[model samples]
Target: MKEVVFQASLDGNCLFLNPAWETITGYSVAESQGRQLLDFVREDDRPCIQTYLEQVKTGKQSSDHPVIRLSHKMGSFRFVEIFVWQTLNKHQQVNGLSGTLIDITDRRQAEAALRESEERFRQIADNMEEMFWIRDLRERKFLYINSAYEAFSGLSPQPLFSDENAFLDFVFEPDRDTVLRVFQEVEQSLSYQFRARHRDGSWRWLRVRAFSIQEGGSPSRRIGISADITSILEREQILEVSLKKEQELNALKSQFIATASHEFKTPLTAISSSVELVRYYLNREPQTPFTAVLTKHLNAISDRTTGLDELIMDTLTLSKLDEGKIQVCFQEVDLVALVEQVIVANFTNREDSRQVAVSVLGDPVWVTIDVKLMSHVLTNLLSNAFKFSSTNPGLVIEFSEHAVRLVVTDQGIGIPEKDRAYLFGKFFRASNVHQIKGTGLGLAICKEYVELMQGYLGVDSTEGIGTMFTITFEK
Candidate 1:
């Protein structure tokens, strides 16, 4: 049998030598003789070599896993992992040691690159706003979820993914079946829109896209991203409502143009006939009996024409207000005088004008307002009061200070509570008050005028008792 060769040394400088080492370093046995082992090691690895030598000198089992760069035969460094063990003398004294070197540079580089790739993936998942998730399809459990999912859902992914049924429970009831169906069709496609409950108890529209990970000819994993689309949904709803309002306004404008043309023509025709009669009759003989009657009929025509003119002016004012084109000039004006003028203009025919008492209270002072608008406001209120209170002859209009108050108290049938809310709305008439003829725009126009003057207008009524329309202006 051939004898096996071994390398051993007592001095640390001439540590271990082997035929394999000489072959690897391109040094013959004779050339390596008497050379310090440190001389053959790479300069940067000398310290680690010394440490391992010290451990062997103490007769201890030195750790073999030493990451060192060693000199190759071509004078270049070779990265190696070394495992060393100590040899002991018969008397338990330290002698020498043996070690095995394995080149591991390629394996180390691959491991380092893999670690960097994983770190990059982690950073992206943490920073994304969209919720990201991965699930083990075979186990029917979530394997990972990004931070955004926890923020939106008010729950961490751990418990949700731990139990297969937990994720199904969190899905909105209406969307559960759809989600399941889409998930089952993962082999075909894995993208869908669905609603999910948010942390704030609101629902969010989410677009989810996913793909299946196949293993061994079967789907084993799934990955997806979920994005919130709540704002998009809200914008769509707003656009829908705005479009509906624009259509309604267009229809209203068409009807208004037709009604206004007819209303104006009727008054103009009456005025024209009266003017023609006046011109013809004035040329007739004096003291004629028909003169007084014709004159009286002409005056009646003038009054009706004036009333129609006022109605047209009111409608124009309302249109300007709607278009935000009316410029109000507010100033201090006497509330008492304003109310008195409205009463006289609307009720000059009252035979018992003295019977209607007008009381001025508070500072009897002036309030900031636009007088023209305020006059229209008072006219609407007083006209409504007179129309509703012809049976109750003693109608009272009152005024006060801190606010200019007008109480058009009547003994007429009052408005019901249910109808009060819509009283100030355009074209609204009380159910009981419909028997009387009106444009149904008086109170609504009154409200707009009052509000433009920075005042409030309202009505209080009880069916069968009486109705009181009140206007209050800030002093």
Candidate 2:
């Protein structure tokens, strides 16, 4: 009877009777003896209490572990584990049941919290992109792997616990030795990088970081993470290749410029000597037909000299652009009149006069620009167009108010698509255009000048369909 007092019962009419029950509920025996037990059971706990009592009355045992409710006098809830067992009469007939209740509120709450923490950690590991792994160094096998590893490798690492070499087999052939060496060093180190072959037959750069876990009397274990660094590795390779190519291109440009300068000097000296001879003859000429012939030769010499001068100037401009020496000064000017003047200056030759026709479009309006550089740009484009279109008569030049455009369209021969990329590169000539007399510096110089003046220059051409060189200067 004394042990039975540790349990409590409320009959159909709700009466709490027992010294131990009073002690557990923080109520005097007198206060609980005739009061409804529902008064002690929290409202939220009444349903479970009723269900449990009903189960006991139906010859069923109350196996529910524990529940919580406030004590009447203590004013705080306490956990109680309730267990019911049937008692027998002396004659071995059926009898009412008795129950044992123990306090377990604190222990149950701790267990629930631990479960929630574990679930949260699992969710984090599963959703992460980086491969996470844990291994027992003593056993030399994987103990755990995150979902990311399984997806990345195409094979779950969980089975690798029995075969320590499984991970080694997945390393790329070129990086296998390095990875093995790194692993050997990891016993003393904590991190390394290597390449691993992915399931898609490509390789990924992987950075691995690990720490050793020491357990008392047991071998040390290792926890590691592997991150994919393929994009970083690719960018590094691309940068290296680009740097090497730029160096080679720079060297090539220097050599080409040196050769072009030497080539231009010879032509320039011949033209200068021819000009001096013409001046000497003109000083004593009696205006004879022979004098006119000499004058024509002098004009030819002058044209050749002008061509050589332009070539030299183009080379010098490109060199300056390469060295970042050119500066632009923006000012308002009549772009239409500027284009007309450049065309007149460049169209002086009989061949140019007979072959190309010049035209203007739109109203003449003042526009902001660097006049000197813009004139150079327009002259180069018109000269190139006329030079290429020498066989085709009536090549036209066009202009507008809001924009100053020069179209030097040639019908002689056209550029190929593959050669377009190198069109603006110094000393680069299309395969078809190589036969045409040119230093190939004209367009490159034009690009630099146009860009310096904040204008746009481009070309359009097709094989056998002729070519059009266009320059649009901002107003």
Candidate 3:
């Protein structure tokens, strides 16, 4: 039998014991008989057994089912429950006490482990920075809430148990509707960001995420976490304001540059015209040494004026590009024809012994590009090529079914490795080309123009050896 029955006198001495007593305590029935039942109980729990026996002796008739520890013959202990009843003789007077013992060690041990696990969970949740909660939707009650909620809402968490909306009352007025809608519409999981009023009446941002507990295809509970995000939102707001201010400052700077470049053009034009008139008058009697010196100085002034004018024009173009004033008009142009036109117009009067060799891999390659911009790009590239190289330069035009490439290769004083990274920046001159007469805006302008036509401009160069500039476009 799983249960052991025993009979003891009112004084608590055992008179009879079932055979199962041997299985329970590892002691034979004969060894267990005539011994006090309290002898088998743990020292601390024996008093409980004694009280139970006293109660049964007073005609209590039933045991209180007190749990007590029983010692085994091997010196180990087991938890057991005691069930007692009073025996009555023919005269109806209580004569003996009878009871049953049932082993409950496994049940008691399981309950202990479960209590320990719950304690650990509570410790972790209470100390977390985020608010953790469990709500029973069917019962309309909050089953669990950690202490962090009190810190977040600035109110005691106790009131939240009775009022489901107590915590939501602190949500920012504008966000409360949305928060409620989300709660009503959420099926399985939820996530949202909202603002709430803290205890000090200051607003704070919070992000919440939740999962629903389902029962029979419907939600019956929700478990969720909410975290404070006020600092993160503040940082994001600051960054947005900074970016907007920077953009406005850049626009104002571009406008100022365009205005200044325009203001310089009138004076430069007057200087060029006066130099031409003076040259016209001096050429009529330019035979003496004095007159020849006058003529030379006039030519120098004219050249310098022209250089200044080119610089102003480049500056204006850059400002327009920054202000989004330039318009792009892509059209089908013959690449071979455009190359020939640029070479004839720009490099024809070069006094250097070096020449430009045009190599046409496929004749008359056609591409879609802005004619004016592409011409300017080609002119700038070829001008740089001829100006930098003392040896012959080469321009190759190659085209296939889907793409076209223009390569301008020159054996010039190539750019330094350190300067290549900033080559396309405005007014950036190479470290090795300080003596070269350049405003440093030509390549920058060329790059912007090329990109406007949906093309790419790239260069490969080695210092003092050679440089190659490639422009590629989709055909």
Which is the leading candidate under TM-score? 3
- Kindly list the per-residue Cα lDDT of model 3 for residues 1-475, writing each as its tens digit: 6578989998888999888788888988887888888889999998777877777787663524898888999999888888889889999998998888998888999999999999999999999999999999887778899988888787887887998777778888999889888866546898999998887889999898999989998999999899999998889999999989988998888878777777888788888889988888888884999998898899889878888888988988988898788999987888788888888887776676556799888656568899999999988888888788787789999876777899999998998999899999998999988877889999999999999988999999999998999999876
Off by over 4 Å in 2: 1-271, 278-311, 349-352, 355-364, 390-406, 473-475
Instruction: Please provide the root mean square deviation of candidate 1 (C-alpha atoms, Å).
Output: 19.6
Of the candidates shown, which would achieve the greatest lDDT relative to the real structure? 3
In model 3, the worst 10-residue window by lDDT is 55-64
Residue-level lDDT of model 2, residues 1-475, one tens digit each, is 2221322333533233456665566777776655655567778888886677667667674455446463558677666656654456798654544565566666878999999998998898889899987777776777778898778878768567788667887887888887777665435347778888787878888998887776885447877889998998889999999989987897688667877877888878887887988688696868888888878888877877876776787776676687677888889887667766776776666643453565656655677778888887766666666666646423343455466666667775678889988998888989887656787887888787887777788888887877887777755
Candidate 2, residue 292: lDDT? 86
Ranking by TM-score: 3, 2, 1
Q: In candidate 3, residue 10 scores what lDDT? A: 85
- What TM-score, to 2 decimals, does candidate 1 have? 0.45
How far out, in Å, is residue 168 in model 2?
29
Please give the ranking of all candidate structures by lDDT, highest first, separated by commas: 3, 1, 2
In order of appearance, the predictions have TM-scores of 0.45, 0.45, 0.64
| Clashing residue pairs for model 3 | none
Give all candidates' CA lDDT scores.
Answer: 0.72, 0.71, 0.87
